[model samples]
Target chain A: MAIPKDKMLEMLHSLLLSRRFEEALTELCQVEGKIPGMMILCTGQEAVGAGVCAALRPGDVIITNHRSHAHLLAKGADPKVLMAEIYGKRTGCNKGKSGTLHLALPEIGAPCTSTVVGAGPPMAVGRAFAQQYRGEPAVTVCFVGDGATGEGSFHEALNLASLWNLPVIFVCENNCYAGAQRLEEHTRIENIADRAAAYCMPGVVVDGNDAPAIYTTALDARARAAAGQGPTLIECKTYRWRGHGESDPQHYQPKEEIAAWRARCPVARMREAVLALGLISTDDLSAMETKVDALVREAIRFAEESPYPEPREALEDVYA
Target chain B: MPQLTVGQALNQALREEMTRDDTVFIAGEGVGVSIHDNPMLPTAGLLRDFGPRRVRDTPVSEAAIAGLAVGAAEAGLKPVVEIMFNPFFTLASDMIVNHAAKLRYLSGGKSAFPLVVRIKSGAGFSAGCQHSHNLEAWTAHCPGLKVVMPATAADAKGLLKSAIRDPNPVVFFEDMMLYFAPGPVPEDEYLLPIGQADVKRPGRDVTVVTWSRMLGVAFKAAEQLAAEGIDLEIVDLRTLAPLDKETVLASVRKTGRLVVLHEATRTGGFAGEVAAVVMEEAFESLKAPLRRVTGPDIPVPASPPLERFYIPDAEQVITAVKDIM
Candidate 1:
């Protein structure tokens, strides 16, 4: 799909904003001890989240696993709420009760994200099933990592989705590794998309760093789902810019491999492409950066000022 | 009104609810098949009647079975999941504890799970340690879950119907041993609210609280004791969580003696929790300390002789009631 010049610039701006936001969070973790330890940076994987979310309407549902900051941001969740959740403050989504691993925003239809591997797939199927049963046009998008494909729930969820013809889009952010183990070391299949054939569903592979490519693929899948063609599996080929979590030193990945991926950084490449096309002026780009920086600063201030939940509140909310 | 067994009553309740509401459905393993033509016979014709969409036979993945039920319930479906054996509940604790029980509260009261989990509990028929274990106490400890253990056919039907209609997650425990136990059941549709305790056989001497298969044992013990002029008040705790402390305390105040019974192991059993409640609420009303008659703190044995020894029978209940008196 050929991207419109204006849309291309918009994608570039969004990716850069996500990149800068994550960078700021990383620095905040160092100086203020805000994020506890080493954090997973969605540096190279920004395009997949940004592209897919951009195609979704406001009421459309999105579910994701542990590696989810980019997805939440892409779905328009306030950075303040996201940051406050990470800081475990009441101002956070889920009232800081669900931390980073399990944040929820019902207003945006991002109900909650699960930390358990492959848990979101079945939930996404459930949501899609509900939409189907209610005759609602809303679609449910589930974001999972390559590691999740190994889980039995993933297979069960896919089969159920196919059987029910649920309007669900399964986006596999294949970052090449499940923690430190590479995809080749785990599954016999070269592409996770190939597994979709067994379920008789459309499966596509895309350069996850290419925003237009991901957005076009996701758009096509969404159309197919809306037309009652059942679920689609979109395997996003990307790389994680940081270790699995904040704690990993990443001795498993070679320095050259890291360097090679860094050269194709989603944000930097998109920004250069937009600049070369003259779609956005340098002043407009700098102003956008300044605005994002100010927004992040305000969010941090709001999070820092938010109250810690009362100790007695722990016993509350265990039931309705 | 008509008489029915506990199993038949439960099946009737499920059928009625599924007929009344389009959102209600059944899911689990061996639900569509009549295992031994007794345990799953209640659900035998349900699949054929309701079709595969409403009556599903899930794979032997307990976690997925439970997780799918939770997901479906959250999406506004009233799903009743059958966990063939009670001990297998441990595999689905993530859905039971973290998902179903907490979804409403976590959603800030914006969501109601309305899921029902049906499982067979207790030691009998030589179904050893794993299959026969009673874990009501474990489930009752959780805040959001409503635990129900019906001792009679009427309660089995009424309570199961209410659980399907309830807007919260409920764990419905059925005693495998009581599947053949018969009692009076109303033919017309009815509902029994969760958290109510029923006084099966009222007396003035000592109060005996029990549930599930042990209710029968308590009743037998009361009957035997009545012959000796030792009138016993038997309170069937149909629901474990949201316990009817009012009924228990009122009975305790009048009798001034208490005996709690269960087929589960003594330590950390539901009996212990009942004892704690009695001590906390009606300490001054007690003529004697609360006595608990329960299974020994060990795995249920597979042999018939050893299984008989593993569970508390009528004699044990009589002894515990007399000791309290």
Candidate 2:
């Protein structure tokens, strides 16, 4: 499906916002000791999250793995609360109880995210099953890394989803590497999509840098799911612009390979596409950037001023 | 009141809960099917009665089974998942420890995981190390989970009913040996609070605290002591977490000697926790330092004689009680 002019511009803006947010977080972690330990940056894989979330309805749910900032942003989680969470403040999403790895927002249907690899697939299936049981049209979109496909839960979830014809979309962000290990070393399959054939599902691989292509593919998968046609395995061919997490020496990939991926950056590619089509004016694009920058600044300021959680509150939510 | 076995009581509780709450369901291996020759026995007619939607026979993935239960419970379904064997709990520990035990806490009290995980435990009939291990202490160590080990048919019926209705994750440990053990069980529906302890035999000479199959061994030991005119008080710790420390302390205070017993190993058995509670709360009342009559600190052996030597029987309990007294 052809994307509308306004939506295409919005997608470009969202992708840019995600990239800039990660860049800012990286800088904050380095200079200010804001995020104490390692912070996984979704630098080059912005389009995967933006496109997948764009297809989701208000009631639809999305489950994400450890590298989850992009998913949260795409699902409309307030950057301010997210920043506060990273700051370990009381006003954060988990009241500073969970760091970036575990974030949740039940009201918006992004109930929870896990750090464990391949954990989201089965959970997403469960959420989809719940929705189906309630006769709700809400679908569950599970965002996983290329490395997560190697876990047993991933295959089990796929088989179950196919057998039950669950309304779950498994989106594999194949960023070429799982930590320091390359995807080629992990699996012999030519494409992550090829494995989906074993489960009797449609598998499609799309250029992850193209926002419109990713968005269109996700929309098709969502549509198929809503029609009770079962799940779609979507392999997003993306790359990580930065090291796996902060403080990594990044000895696996050469500088040339990193520079090559940076050249095809999703945010820049989307911007060029929109500008070439004359879909958005230069001034409009500049204004959007300023707005996003100001929003991010406000979030950082809120996080800086937010109070840390009380020590006594630690045991309060242990059980419900 | 009707005479019912522990397994029958469990079936009765599950049936009662399912009938009362439309959201309650059962999912596990051999749940909907009659795999054991006890064909269609415990969950006998549940599949036909509730249909495939409610009585689901899951794939042979304990992790998936448990993860699915957690998800279902979080989504407002009361799920009773069967692990078939106690040793299989190792496979599901990720869900039990990470998700089921931490969901409410991680969600900041926004979600409740009302999941009851039922597993058959104990080393009888030569089921060997893998099938016979008792890991209640491992579960009890977890903060958010409520662990229940009912020794009697009545307690099984009452506790299972309570577990299904509870708004927290509960690990219900059912001893395979007690499945056929019969006792008087109430016919009408009832709920037993999770943290309460039951005193099986009242005595002042020594206190014997145990639960699950070991509780029966403790009682038999109490009887042998009674024949010799040595009074023995037996306290059944029905729930592990939110333990009935008050009852245990009171019993220890009255008897002035205490012996904690269980089928699990002595190193980190539930008995150790009971001993700690006694030492912490009623240390002055002890005639001697607390004694723990537990299975040896080894895997349950395969041979009948070796398993007999490994597990703490009534004679061992009697010996421990006498030594403490």
Candidate 3:
């Protein structure tokens, strides 16, 4: 299925913005030491979040994992508040409580993100179950890393979603590693999507680095869910260019592998594709890059300028 | 008012809440089919009354069951889910503890996770440690959760109703042995506030703090002790978290003696918490060292005789009270 040039441009913009925001965050956390906590970045895996979220509507629910900035950006979460959260500012989406790992924007249908591996799917099932119970046509999208697939929670979630024929899409970003452990070392299965057949759901594998490919797959999954066809497992085989968390030295992964994945950057690929469509020029792409850079800088400035919550605020959110 | 079992009271609460609000639903394994075939158990006729959409019978997936409640609650629906056995709560703890309990706080108080997780607990049926363990302390320790264990039919109905309406996650524990025990339940609908203690019996000699089925043991011991002229005042803490420390301390101050009683094993039991509170707040008023009448620090054995021994009985309560006296 061919995507329109306008939608492609929008996705290209989201890709650029996500890449620029993360790059700025990395600098703040690593060089400047401004950000705190264990922040995980979606450096090279931008296409999966951008493409999949672009296929969804604003009201569609999304259950995010620890590496969640890209998906939140694609789903229209305010980057300024997200950055403020990373800075532990009171202006943050979670009022400095969630930090970077557990940010959520419920108004946009992206509830709290789970830092626990394999936890999002079961909650996604609940969100979908609520949607179905309320007779709403909205679908729920659950994002997880390849490592999450090995969790028993993930399997249980899949079984229940299928058994109930609920509207949910499980998007597994196969970045070839679960933390420092490579895919082969962690899971014996060659294709994570193949496990969907065991649960009697459609299994589709897409190119993780290819935005159009992932968008197409996610669109079909969303449609199937809308038609009451239950869930579909879409595995996007991608790679992360950075370490699992901010503190990791990444001695486990080879330099050559990182360099190779870096060469296949999703942002550059989407930019080139947009340029090839002849709807935008190199200058236009450059202008877009400059704008995205400014947006990231503004978000950082907002976060830095924001005040930390009072110590007593920690006791505030424990109950309703 | 009518005489009803705790199970019947719980059923009345569920039925009333579901009828009052369309958003309230019940989900669990065999909730709809009544697989246990115990008419006294809640959800006995719920599937037929509320239909499958509200009274869902799910697979034996505790984690998913709890997670579903978390999501549903977050989505603005009030979900009251069940874990067949309290010990099985270990499987569902991640969703209940990590997600439901923390989501509201983690959302910076921007969200309210209004849900209830109903669990059947207590040891006496020889269901072994896995099915019979009373782990209220596990949940009560968490900040965001409200833990409740009701001993009477009226409190069961009233508390469950309040829990369903509460705009936070609540862990409601029902004793398996109390399912058929008869108590007076009001016919009209009513709600009990969480985090309050009830003075079951009033006396000044000794204060015995307990809840759930352990209340029966305390009451039985009180009867035997009354004949001996060592009067016992009983305090039932309906809500464990947001503990009614004022009530507990007041009772301790009046009696000038205290005994914490529970069926859970001693080491990490909530009884220790009660004892600590007394030591900290009522130390000057205490006439004797605080005593804990709790089960041994060991897993509940499956053998009937051994299980009976594993559970703290009225004899233990009486002995602890006498020792303090």
> What is the interface root-mean-square deviation of candidate 2?
1.4
lDDT of 2 by residue, A187-285 (tens): 898699988999999999999877889999999999999889999999999998788888787999889999999889888888888888899889998
- How far in Å is the alpha carbon of A55 misplaced in model 1? 3.6
TM-score of chain A of each: 0.95, 0.98, 0.98
For residues B135-173, could you state the per-residue lDDT of candidate 2 as single tens digits?
Answer: 999999999999999999999999999999999999999
The model with the greater lDDT, 1 or 2, is 2
Pairs that collide in candidate 1 are A38-A246, A39-A246
Poorly placed runs, candidate 1 (over 4 Å): A3-10, A32-41, A180-190, A194-203, A275-283, B33-44, B108-110, B187-189
What TM-score does structure 2 among the candidates reach? 0.97
For every candidate in turn, the CA RMSD to the true structure comes to 3.1, 1.6, 1.0
The model with the greater TM-score, 1 or 3, is: 3
Residues B1-325 of candidate 1: C-alpha lDDT, one tens digit per residue:
7878888888889899999998888878888764555643457688878888788777676776776677667778888888989998987776787777875665545567888999878788787888888889899988899999999999999999999988889999999778788889998688988899999988999999999888888888988999999999999999998899999999999999999989999889988888888999999999988888999999999999998988898898888777766
lDDT of 3 by residue, A250-291 (tens): 999999999988888898999888888787988988898899
Candidate 2 stretches greater than 4 Å from native: B37-41
Candidate 3 all-Cα RMSD: 1.0
The candidate that achieves the highest TM-score relative to the unseen native structure: 3
Model 1, global lDDT: 0.82
Better of 1 and 2 by DockQ: 2
